[model samples]
Target: MNVETTVADSSLLRQRAFVAFWLARTCSSFGFQMFSVAVSWQIYSLTNSALALGMIGLMQFLPSVLLALPAGHLADQFDRRRIVICAQLIEWGALLALVLLTLFSWTDKTALWGLVFVLAVAKALEGPAMTSMLPSLVPPAILARATAANAVGGEAAVIVGPTLGGFLYVAGPDVVYSVSAAFYLLSLVLIGRIRYTRPQQPRLPASLSTLFAGIHFIRARKDVLGVISLDLFAVLLGGATALLPIFAKDILHTGPWGLGMLRGAPSIGALLVGLWLSRNKLEKNVGMIMFGSVAGFGVATLIFALSSQLWLSLLALAALGGFDMVSMVIRGSLVQLDTPDDMRGRVNAVNAIFINTSNQLGEFESGVLAAFMGAVPAAVLGGVGTLVVVGVWMVLFPHLRRRQKLENEAAQE
Candidate 1:
């Protein structure tokens, strides 16, 4: 069989809508990461409570659970561009509020909680709309390339944002918040320039029935469900990010600069892998690659847990990031390729819920476990748990392993 090439057509790369959307997304992500670091640092300084830091994750997750279904329905019913613009505006407003609270010297714990909760609401509104707009900006044939490019852009932000935020924090937290607000406003303007023909909406009831449609769609596709479950469990167990502050201060014996490197290392690894995969098609068995990469991630986490040397731990994180990127690109491409265009919004909404929930749940679990046992034990247990998930998924979803064979056979037909 001939190899399926993955390089995107040069002309599509020059398309105005795709370029505009990409720029807007990349800029927005940079600002978002900066704010994330600033908020976590501020809350920890003010309250000195791990549970409070965990609450920040919970605030974001709860809104995604409650609003994602409705937000998906709105994406289907309204103009996606407008939905994105409005969400950006809300984000800008939240940032501005944060800035004012800082300016007025209202830096109390209650005020910080209010700021986090408002930001959570904004993220819940934005997440589904942003994801559902992807297919509309580029054709289906180059969707994988687009996904890779998108990941690269986000990872770039991750590289720059945290490093910048850490430096700015030495000046003041207010500087970080103000800079983030400015970026959000700029992103809003950039998004307004994209001009794509919005698809016509399908007439559907505005009821619980329509929301359940997304669940039904996922239930029928064994391959899609398998990939999602793999990601959900792997991330839930292997995520040690919520404990980074503890590691940075206690184990690494470094300051905020070290924290920035720890946060940015994985994204750097992910960026490198994304760039490489964008050029080469996945002609091999993708299922094996996905599971193998995830297992590799678990091993990397174990290395990170045991290492005393800071540089060695950074190397381990970089490897984990690269493996995680491979899993993400494979699963994301499968989801987009399998779903019908009309159902993309709801399907993506379901994906958002699962992915975001796993992140927060992992954070909460890590925090609780760290408080009870210790950071080292919590990190070690999380890695062990990920290995168990990999074993369970391999036995439960044999079809995922057969996915490449199925694709090759279809191409021959």
Candidate 2:
């Protein structure tokens, strides 16, 4: 009875610190999702240039790449909770700046993207700490379940946030910014309230070696590097998220509301997958599962790229999200489980850079290519590129493919 009870209570929701962290993550995710939608729409409205749309991705990507190592160093050298709290506060202030700018009906569009750049800076700085903080809040036995739960909440936010942002954006950009600011503020408060477990380790000084430690660690670990690189190139080629506004308006002719639904479809699929993962968990052939998922993501993206029917596009996107969730859950668990507490911050920082490449950089790639060849061709070409990446990775990382389970891997020393 005691063992059963203990196992039942192992879920992160039953733990105070994890609950607080979960709330903080969810609220922050919601606000960021809204920011993504609002910014893409606003920028496109201000200037119809596809290249200008690409610039937003570059602006966000540059800060993240530049700050990755420093952010990891900061996370290692400080109380991670405090680092996250400060970042959330900065994010809050950035949203407020957006609110003020929009409310004033400001015509200086450059200033608008400038505030986005500021927000990106804060978020990039905080990424390492936040990723490293998760394991500290829960028992390792149920960490996968906790992560799945977190994904479910995050995916839910992804669904509601963009849809809400779009609907509210129609009311006015002022409304979206104000609400986003409020969510960020709430996340800040929630993170401030949490008390997380901190492992004792040597706090390295802010030197070049200390900053670049994450890079060094990744290079040493082939599995980590392989999975991270696979995701990076796959998403970099396959991602069409940043081009969503163009798809919504130009291809589908459905407007912002359709864009919201399009954006939400993937999250809806991910949410369902996340819930399932929380229950079953993975204990075998994780590598194969992850690779398969990524391939499925590409196939779905290809389908989405070719679809003109709203229903078909939405279904394709949902499949894309579902495939993405499987890999996300599996890879995230592997990263945290395989890494030591001391080095996790740095490793996660590097991981963030790789993952962000697929996201922001991928968006930039889409926009640039869209400007040249047209959106449909750009997306179709990306899907083909993603498939090629999968085939190449299978040959390059045979050990990763042979790995049978997440458990046998040794934690970083």
Candidate 3:
């Protein structure tokens, strides 16, 4: 086992395809983050309406909700790499258009929204293809570590992208858009360099059943269902981070600087932990560890909710982020490792919907609950609810709770 692990660890470091994929994924993240900052600023500058800003999110979210399953089906039936490339190509074209329009002073709020929607549509199609490709790039033994490494790239991009965009925007919106487009071009080129053995899958006809195969696949696998749903409910209940602004302004009596630091705490924590996990392995009692990490996340959320001190709140938020990272890495690795290659795209699509919707809805849930009660109580309730969910899920999915490895079912077959 030690020899095997040594080989796996080395394989991860030397895997060329995975390396390209990681670089491509990181470039894509940087572009997306830069584009987000540019578009938001441009939209608000044009309309100066908060409603218009809200509509941007609505437009972006609508496509994922509507197209994710179809996108999944497409991933299953075609070259996953090509699908990702095509989606990013579309995004790159949109960014180019944005650059031209902004340069000419021809872009309006409506045009911006339309462009944002197009980008979102491409993202919806790209997400599942990108996610489902990871398991094929490296040995299953290192998938969790690879996932952590992937996340570290994203975390680094998130920390840097917006600030970079903001600085470039000083030159103008067009400059930011131009730089973002360049990143997408790099991502496309890197993706083109990736090589993988595509499994021979039967050409499944398009039908309701085919489109929804991922749902059925997940439902039949109790372990997969448990992991997916546990994340959904736990995140849905533990979205107290959404109340940061409220806490900063009303409770903590601080300025935007404080809010910025508060907002950044979680990402910093996640990034540090991700770096560690990338070098280390989670080789034993993974299921229990995942559950415990989630419970720890809840405990951190509860502490953050109750804390009146800024330092303590930041610490709690950071802890929650670290815990959440552990859970995310475990859950993602397990699902991908256990799934068949033919069904991976569709399954990941369903998983994407769960992840995306849970985050958006979790924030929405916290805001609504905060409106009814108060930020503190709402956050406290969310933390407690997350803990309750962890307990319930452990009871409900005994097999998942006792699971010990991240072995690839397809490889064994």
CA lDDT of each candidate? 0.82, 0.84, 0.92
The segments of candidate 1 whose C-alpha lies over 4 angstroms from its true place after superposition are 1-14, 40-55, 104-112, 169-174, 243-260, 367-381, 405-413
Instruction: Please report the TM-score between candidate 3 and the true structure.
Output: 0.96
Residues 243-320 of candidate 2 have per-residue lDDT tens digits of 788888888889777987988889889999999988786777888998899999989888988989888999999999
Residue-pair clashes per candidate, as listed?
Answer: 0, 0, 0
Which model is ahead, 1 or 2, in terms of lDDT?
A: 2
**Per-residue C-alpha lDDT of model 1 across residues 1-413, encoded as one tens digit per residue:** 33333244434544677888888898899889999989889989988999989788777667889988888777777777788899888888888888888778888777777777777787777776787777777766667777888899999988889779989989888899999988888889888987756568667877987886777888888777888888998888887877888988999898988887887789889999999877767776888888888988998888888777789889989999999998898889888777766777788888888998898788889899989999988999998899888888888887786567213133211
Query: What TM-score do all the candidates reach, one by one?
Result: 0.85, 0.84, 0.96
Error of model 1, residue 232, in angstroms? 0.9
Runs in model 3 lying further than 4 Å from the true structure: 1-14, 408-413
Task: Note the residue pairs that clash in candidate 2.
Answer: none
User: What is the C-alpha lDDT profile of model 3 across 1-413, one tens digit per residue?
Assistant: 69999988767655988999999999999999999999999999888999999999999999998999999998888899999999999999999999999989999999999999999999999988899889888878899999999999999999899999999999999999999999999999999988866787888888999999999999988889999999999989999999999999998888999999899999999999999999999988888999999999999999999998899999998999899999999999999988888999899999999998999999999999999999999999999999999999999998787888877432220
Where in model 2 is the C-alpha error above 4 Å? 1-14, 36-58, 97-111, 169-174, 240-260, 305-310, 364-381, 408-413
Considering every candidate listed, which one attains the maximal TM-score?
3
